[model samples]
Target: MLKPLPDTVKGPAMRLQHMVMTFRSALVDRLVAHDPALSRVRMGARVTLSILISIAALIAFHFLVTPLPSISYALAIVLSIEGGVAVRDRTPGEQLKTRLIGCAASLFCISLAALLEGYRLVADLAFLGVILAASLARVYGQRGFAVGMFAFISYFMGAYLKPTFAELPLAALGPLFAVTIGHLVRTFLFPEDWRRDLRAALKAMQGRVMDILVRLSVLSKEGRVTENDRTELRHMEEQLKDVVLMAEGLLPRQVDGTAHSDDDPVTALSMAIFDLHLSAESAIVQSLETPPPFVLVHAVISGDRDLAEKVAASTAVEKGGETARASAQALLWLQRSLQALGRAAGKEAGGLASIDDRVVDEPPTKPDFSWKNPLVRAAAQITIAAGIAMIFGLFLSRERWFWAVLTAFLTFNNTKSRGDAAIRAMQRSVGTALGIIIGLAAATLLAGHTVSTVILASACVFLAFYFLQVSYALLSFFVTIVLCLVYGLIGQLTLDVLLLRVEETMIGAVAGTFVAFVVFPASTRSNVDLALARWYDALGQLLDAARDGESRYRVIELSSRLDAAYRELTVAARPLGSAWSLVTRPGPIRQTLAMFLATSYWARIFAHDFAEAKKPLDPDVLTAIEEARAALSKAAARGSDCFATRKPRPVMAGNAAPAFRQGAAMGADRVANLLNRLYPA
Candidate 1:
C-alpha cells in the first residue's frame, strides 16, 4: 500500500462525511414528515424537467430555423409547466385529451388578446368578462379548470407581450410545442404506476414503524421515559397516521376477476401497523420497567421469524406492578401484530391476481350555479380581487399591471376563507421582499455572463417547483429570482424594475385580502364548524356500526370516512393557531382547537380498540355511545354548544375487556370534559 494519509486531511474528510450524512437525514425526515409518499416531490421534479427541456428545444429551434420571439419562449415554458401538473392521476389518453384542449384554449386566447390590443377600453372590459367566464368554467370539473387556467394565462401573456398581428402565427406554435414536450415527458419519463407507488408507500410505513420501535426499545431499556420522549412519540404517531391514510387512499377499489373485499392484504397490513403503534404508545406512557424483548425487536427489524417467535413466546410471563403489567400486555399484542404484519407483507409481495386497470369515466352532472356553490363563490371573489388589483396596478405601472392581477387571482386559487387569503397574501409579499435582496446580489454577481444567467434561471425554476408544496414562500422566492434573470437577459434589469415588482406584489396582495374580508367573506370559524359537522357525522356512523356489530367492510369504510373528515377538520382549524385569530378571540378559538384535538385523539383510540376487539358492545357501553351520538348530533346542528344546560354522566362497564373499557371510558370522559370546557355554563 501507499503512504497513509495525514491526520489533517483525514480529520476534515471524516467531518465532511459526517456533515453530509446529517444533512441528508434531516432532509429525509422533513420530506417524510410533510409527504410520506413523496408524491409532491415527484410532481415538482416532472414539471421542472419538462420546462427545462422545453427551453432547450426552443433555443435549438431558434438557431436552426427562423428566430422566435422571446414571448413565444416564455409562453411555451408556462404551458409546459401547467401541462405537467394537469396530467397527474389521469390515464395517458385523458392526459393527451387534456393537453390538446389546453393548447386549443391557449391559442384562441392569445389570438383574441392580440387582435384586441389597440382597443384599450374594450380590452379592459373584455378582460373582466374573460375572468368571469374562466371562473365559471370550473363547473366542468378538472378539464374545465385546466382550460380556464390556460385561457387566463394565455390572454395575460398576449396583453403583456403585446404581440403584433404579423407575429401571431409564430406565437401560436408555443402551446403546440409545449403540449408535445409535456406529453412525451409525462408518458415516457414519469408515468404513474399505482402498484409501484402503493408498494413503496407500504415499505416507507414499515420503515417508520421500525424507527419508532427502536426509540421505544431504547427508552424501555433505560427504565426512564422522559417527557420529551413521549412528545416525540406522539409526533411520530401523527406522521405514521398520515402515511397509513395515504396508503389506504391508494388502494384499488376493485381488482379484476376478484371480489373487491375489505380483507385485502394491504388492509390487514395497515391494521397491524395501527395496532403496533397503539401498543407502543401504551408502553411509552406507562414507562415499562422491563425492557422490550430485544431479540424480538431485532427479529422484526431483520425479518427473522424463528427468533421473533421464541422471544415473543418467552415474554408471556406477567411481571411487576399494574403499569408493568400494562406494558407487558402491550408488548404481547405488539408481538402478535408484528407476526400478522409479516404474513400480510408476504402476501402483498405476491401481488394481486388481476388488477382491473380500467379507467371509468365519471358521468356528467348538472353544474351548480347557485350563490352557495363554492365554485361560484370562488370565481366571484377572484374576479372582484383581480378587478381591484388591475385598477391599482394600472396606476402603478400600466405595462406591468398584469402582475398585480395575477397575484390577486392566485391568492384565492385554493384558499377558502378570509384567514387563508390573508395568510397567502402575507407569504407572497414576504417571499418577494426576501427575493429582491437575494436577486439583486445574484444579478450583480452573474452580470455579463449570459450562459451563467441561463443556468441560474433554470436552477431557480427547479427549486421553485420543488418547494411548491413544502413552502409557498420558498416557491415565490425562487420564482422572483427567475424573473430577475429573465429581465437581465432581456436587457431590462434594474434596481427600479425589481422595486416596482415588490410594490406591485404588495398592492395585489392587499387587494386580494380586502376582497376576501369584504365581499362574501368565508370566515375561518364557519369553515371549521362545517368540517366538525362532517367529522361528527362520520364518527357517529362508525360508532353505530361498531356497537351494532355490522360487517367488517362497513366498519372499515366508515372508519376511512372518519379519517378523511378529520383531515379536513385539521386543515380548517389551522387558522386558529395564527396570531390574529388568537388575539381576536383567544378563549373560544383556543378551547375549540383543544376540543377538536382531544376528540380526534380519543375517538381514534376507541375506533382502534373496537376494530380489533370484534365483539358486540356491552349494554352500558352501547347506552353511553348512543348518548354521545345524540349529544354530538345536537352540537353539530347547533354549530356550537350542546352541553350548556346539562352534562351526561360517564359510563364504565365491567363486562368488556380492560383495554376496551379503558378506551371507551377515556374517549367519553375526554369528550365530555373538553366540550364543557369549550361551552361552559
Candidate 2:
C-alpha cells in the first residue's frame, strides 16, 4: 500500500478532485440536454465555413487563373451563405438540385438586372415585378422560396452595383463557385441525419425528464408546493414540449426508408414519455398529502432498476387515502415509463414511426389565390409595404434603398398578423440600433487590422446564423456587425454609413408595420379564435374516440392530432400573451390567457387518463363526458369566446354516481371546473 499523504496535501487534493468532478457532471448534463442553441450553433459553424471556403476559392482563382472584380467576391460570400441555408434538411441529391436551381435563378436575375440598368423607369418596374413574382413563388413551398429569395437578392445586387454587361461573365463565376462549395460543405461537413438527431433528442429528453423529476422530489421533500414551484414546473413543461416536438418531427423522416411494425418501439417510447410527463404533472398539481415512494424516486434517479422495482412493488401494498393511492399509481406509471425508455435506449430497437401514420397518406390541399386567402393577402400586403419602403428609402439614400425594401420584405415574411408584424418590426429596429452601436465600436478597433477584422466578421456571421431562430434582435445585431466589417474592408466604414443603415431599417420596419395594420390586416383575435376552435375540435375528436372505445391505434392517432392542434394554438396565442399585448391591454388578455392555460391543463389530463383507463366509465360519468364532448363540439363550431359570455352548464346531475377510477374522477372534476371558469355564471 502507498504511504499516507500529509493532511494539508490530502485536503487540497480532495478539493481539487471534487471541483473536477463537479465540472465534469455539469458538462455531461449540458451535452445531454439537447438545447436547441447547440443545433443553431452547429448550423452557424457550417454556414461560416462554407462562406470562408468560397471566399478562399475566389481569391485563389483571381491570383492564379483570371482577375475577378471585388463585386464577384462579395457575391460569392452572399451566395455561399444563402445556398448553405437553402439546402438544409434536404438529402444530398436534393441539396445538389436545390443549389443548381438557386444558382440558375441568381444568374438569370443578375444578368437581367444588368441589362436593364440603363433604363431607370424600366429597372424600377422590373424591381417591383421581381418582388411580386418572389412573393407569389412562396406558394410552391421551401424550394420556391429559396429560388425566389436568391433571385431577389441577385437582382438587388445587380441594381445596386450597376455592373456593365462586360463584367457579367466574370461575376457569373461567383454564384457557380459559391453553390459548388456550399454543396460540398453541407454534404460532407455538416450533413443532416435525422436518425442521429432523433437519438440525441431522445437522450436530451431523458435528461430533461430527470431534471423535472429531481426538482419535483426536492419540492416534495419541502412538504408543500408553492406558486413559484408551479411556475417553474410550467416553464419546464414548455421546454419539454419543445423537445417532444423536435423528436416527433424527426421520427417520420427516421422511419421513412426503414421497415417498421404497426407497434413501433419509438412510437411506444414517445407515448410512454408523454404519459409519464402527464402523470408527473398531475402529482404536482394535485399536491397530494403523501409523496411518492422516496426509495423509488431515488432509484429511478440513480438508474437502479432493481431497487426501483422493489420499491414500486412495496408501494402497491402500502397506501392510505385517495391521494395516497393516486401517488402510488403515478409512481407505478413512472416505473413503466422508465422501462419503455430503457428499451428505446437499447441499440437493438427498431426505427421510429410517425406520430400519426394516417396523416402521411392525406393529400395536401390546393392553394387559394382569392383575395380572402391569407397567403394571397400576405403577398399583397408585403408588396405594398415594399413599395412604400422604396419611396421612403429613396429619400434617405438612393443607393441604399434596397436595404429598406429588404427589411420590409423580411418583416412580413413569417408574421401571421398585424400584431406579429409590429412586434417583428420593433425587434428589428431595436436590434439594428444596438447593432450599429456595437458595430461602430468593433469596426473602429479593427480598422487597420485586416486579418483581425476578417476573423471578427466571420465570428459575427456564425453568431448571426446561430441566433437566427432564437432571437431576431440578436441575429440583426450580428448581421449589422458583419456589414460594418464588410464596409471597413472596403475602406467605406463611417458613422454616417452606420446611421444611414439605421434610418433605412427604421423606415422599412415602420412601412411594413403600417401596411400590416392599415391594409388587409390579419387580426390576432381572429387567429387565436381559429386556433382555439381547431384545438377544441381535435380535443372533441380524441375524447369521442376514447369514450367510444376505438382501437388503440385510432385513439393514438386522434391524440397525436390533438397534440398538434394544441401546439398550433399555443403558437397562435403567443401574440395575445406577448409583452406587446400586456403593454396595450394587460387585464383582459391576461385573464383570457389564464383561462386558456387552465383549460389546456385539465383537457390534457382528461385525455391522458381516459385513454389509459382500463374499465368502462360509470354511466353517470359517461353521460357527463358526452355532455362535455357536445359542448366542446359547439365551442369548435362557434368560437372559444362565445362561451365567455354564456352561462356555465352543469356537467352532471346533483345525484349522479361517482366515477369508477379515482384518476378519471379527478380529471373529470377538474375539466368541469375548467369549463366553469371558461363560462362563469
Candidate 3:
C-alpha cells in the first residue's frame, strides 16, 4: 500500500466493509439464532456422535431388523439432538409434547396409509383426506403444527415405504419408535430448560439491540450520514424488529400452580416483556435519525448500571434539542426495561438475563373446530390440490405415483401464500436434484458398509436440521440426501430409484404449485396490504379501548398491541418498501410510509402521557380520537381495495383537527397518494 485515499474514498470503503460485516452477522444469526451451542458444535463432533450412536444401535438391533430401522432410530436421535443437545438444550417438556403428539399422529397415518395401499381409488381419497386434515391442524396452534408435520411424514412413509399386507402392522411403528427414541434422547438424555431457553433468547436479543445502539453511537460520532449509512440503519431496524418478535415468543408460558400472583416480579416481567419490545422498537425508530452523546448511549448499551442511572438522572431534565431528547429517552428506557428483565430472570444484570422459572400459568381452552375457520378453508383447498396431484401422479407412473402425491401433500401443508408455495416448489426441485446427485455419489462410493451408511445419513440429517429454518433450499438438500441414504440402508439405492424419485417429486410439486396458483391463491402483495389494513383497523380498536376510559392498563395494553402490529406490518410489506424507495427522491409513497410511522410515534406518545393521567380524557378529546380512528379505518379500507382490487377508490374529504390526530390524517392522505401512484385515479 503506497498511499492512502482521500476521506471520500475511505469513507465509502469503510461503509462497504461495514455492510459486508453486517451481512455476515445476519447470516450467522439466521443459522444459529435458536440455539447458541448449535453453531459452535463442530462437524467432527457431530460425526463422532453419529458414528458412536450408529455402532451401538446397529449392534443391538442388527439381528431384529436390517440397517433400515437402526438408521431410522439414529434419525430419531438426530431429531432429538436438533431439539436439544447437552444441558444447553432448552424446552425439554415442550419438545417432548411436540414429539409425542407427532409420533402418535405419524404412526396412525402410516398404519392407515398401508391399509389403504391396495385400494387405488380409496387410497387416493384417503390421502386427500389426510392432506386436508393436516391443513386443518393449524387451528390447534403449536399442537396443530406438530400434528400436521408428523401427519405429512407418516403419509409420505406409508405411501412410499410400500409395506406389504403380509408384513405385520408393526411396520407402522417404525416412526413411532424413531420419535419415541428421539424424545427420550432429548428429554432424559439431553434435557433443556424451557425457562432458560426463553431467557437466553431474550438476552441474545437484548445484546443484539445493544450492539445496534453501539454501532449507532459510532456512526453518530462521524457526524456525516450517507446513503450507505441509511441502508445499514434500515437493516438494523429490520433485524431489531425480528429479534423483538423472537424475544416475545420466548416469554414463559403460564404454568398451573405457579406463583403467578399479580404482584409477583416474574409474572410482571413476563407481562412487561411485550412492553419492552414495543418500547425498544419505538426507540430503534427514534434513534435512527438522531442519536444522543456517544458516552451516554454507550453506557446504557454496555449495561453500566451506575452510569446508566447517572445518565438518566442528568438527562431527564436537561434542556436539549428534540432529537437529542428522543435519543436520550430511547436509551434510558431500553436500559431500564432490560435491567428489570435481568432482575426478574434472577441472573446477573448484564451477564445472561435468562429466566430459570415461570410464575404465570393459565388454564387452556378448548380449540375451535368451526367449519368457517381459516384452517377449514386451508384444509378444503389443500385436499383439492392433493387430489389433483394424485391424478397427475397416476398419469406419471402408477408404480411410483406416491412420490407425486407426497409432493402435493407437502407443498401446501403450511404455506400462507402462493409465493411461499411457489418458492417451496422451486426449492424442493433444486434441492432434491442436488441432494440426489450427492447421494448417488455417496451410494456409489460406499454402498456396502453399515457404518458408512449411518455416518453419511447422520451428517445429512444433522445438516438438514441445522439449516431447517435458515434456508429452505439447504434444508431440502440435506433432507433429500438423508432420504436417499435411508434407501441405501435398505440396499435399494439405485439410479432408477433416484431418477424416479426426482421425476415423481417434480411432477407432484409442480401440480401442487399449479393448484396453489389456481385454488384460493394468496398473493403476497394483497396479503401484505390486508395485514397493514388489519393493523390500522387494530389501531382503531386500540383507541376505542383508550376512549372507553375503564382502565388505563387497557389503553396501555392496546397501544402496545398497536405498536407490535405496526412492526409486523412493516416487516411484512418490506418488498413494497423497496418499490416505494425507487422514486429517487422524497415522494408521496415515501412520505406516506413516513407519515404512517409518524402516526405510530405520536399515538405512542399520547398513550404514554395518558398512562399517568389520574382521570379519563376529556369527552371532546375522546371524540377527536374516535373520529381519527374512523378516518384511519376508512383510509385503510381504500388502500386495501386499491391493492386487493385493481381499481382505485375516490378520496372522500374528511375533517381533521387535534394535533395528535394530524398524523393519522396524513396517513390517510398517504394511502390516497399510494393508491393513485400504484393503481391510478
**How far off is residue 36 in model 1, in Å?**
4.1
- Per-residue CA lDDT of model 2 for 383-406, tens digit only, reads 899999999999999888889998
TM-score of 3: 0.72
Sorted by lDDT (best first), the order is 2, 1, 3
Residue-by-residue lDDT tens digits, candidate 3, 1-681:
113333554577786776677677777675555454343234223433534454465456645764343324433443334323221223566666776776677667766877888886787688777777777776777667666766765666567655665442445345444555555554454444445555666666676667677777776687555668666766765565565556555555445643334454444554456546545655655566565666777787777868865765574426656655766777787787777766755633322244344434445777777765656666776777777777877876777787777677667654666656766777788999999999888877777887888778777766775565566688779878877877887887888888988888898788878877777766656656767776777677666766676455555555656667767655455434343222223233344444455555556545555554546576555656656665665566566443333322222111111133332233333333332333344
Error of 2 at 260 (Å): 7.9
Regions of model 1 farther than 4 Å from truth = 1-36, 87-89, 255-259, 266-270, 273-319, 358-363, 582-591, 614-618, 640-681
Q: What 10-residue stretch in candidate 3 is worst by lDDT? A: 649-658
The model with the greater lDDT, 2 or 3, is: 2
Model 2 global lDDT (CA atoms, 0 to 1): 0.72
Candidate models: Cα lDDT each: 0.71, 0.72, 0.60
C-alpha displacement of 116 in model 1, angstroms? Answer: 0.7
Clashing pairs in 2: none
- For model 3, state the Cα shift of residue 671 in Å: 13
Residue 57 CA displacement from its true place in model 1, Å:
1.9
